[model samples]
Target: MTKKMTWNEMSPSQQTGVLVTGSIQLALAATAWIDLAKRPAERVNGPKALWAAIIGINFVGPIAWFIWGRRR
Candidate 1:
């Protein structure tokens, strides 16, 4: 079985990397959510409510919204 390391057990570099990655994901999700909110309902490919639900899904959700939610 693999052991899990707590935050205190992680190296500084590892902790920094984790923080950076978490920040990026948060930014991506936030940007996607804001864009989804600001976009007019008629211009979106589907219902705004549906897209809102999707944007809350985490990294994959926001990426999917950018890839498929917006109308070209």
Candidate 2:
């Protein structure tokens, strides 16, 4: 299900709000990487390897939500 979305219809504040939220969440998501790294400690896998997994979750979910939410 979807609704039509028009960028022209959104106020500047709406766009700004999305951007601000995205950036703040992005920063916080880095912590998820830190959390992931800790899990691998004392194991063979490197802590930094978790960075990829963390970034994947961090970026994908919100992007999907924002894009779909705009349509509605």
Best by lDDT: 1
Model 2 stretches astray by more than 4 angstroms:
1-4, 34-72
What lDDT score goes with residue 59 in model 1? 91
Sliding window of 10 residues with minimal summed lDDT for model 1: 52-61
Q: What's every prediction's RMSD, in angstroms? A: 1.2, 10.8
Runs off by more than 4 Å, candidate 1 = none
What does candidate 2's lDDT look like per residue over 1-72, in tens digits?
887657777789988887898887886556544444454445323334544443566666334333331222
Model 2 clashing residue pairs (backbone): none
Give the C-alpha miss distance for residue 43 in model 2, angstroms: 12
TM-scores, all models, native as reference: 0.88, 0.42
Instruction: Give the per-residue Cα lDDT of candidate 2 at 57.
Output: 69
lDDT of 1 by residue, 18-72 (tens): 9999998899889998999899988799899999888888698899999999987
Q: Which has the greatest TM-score?
A: 1
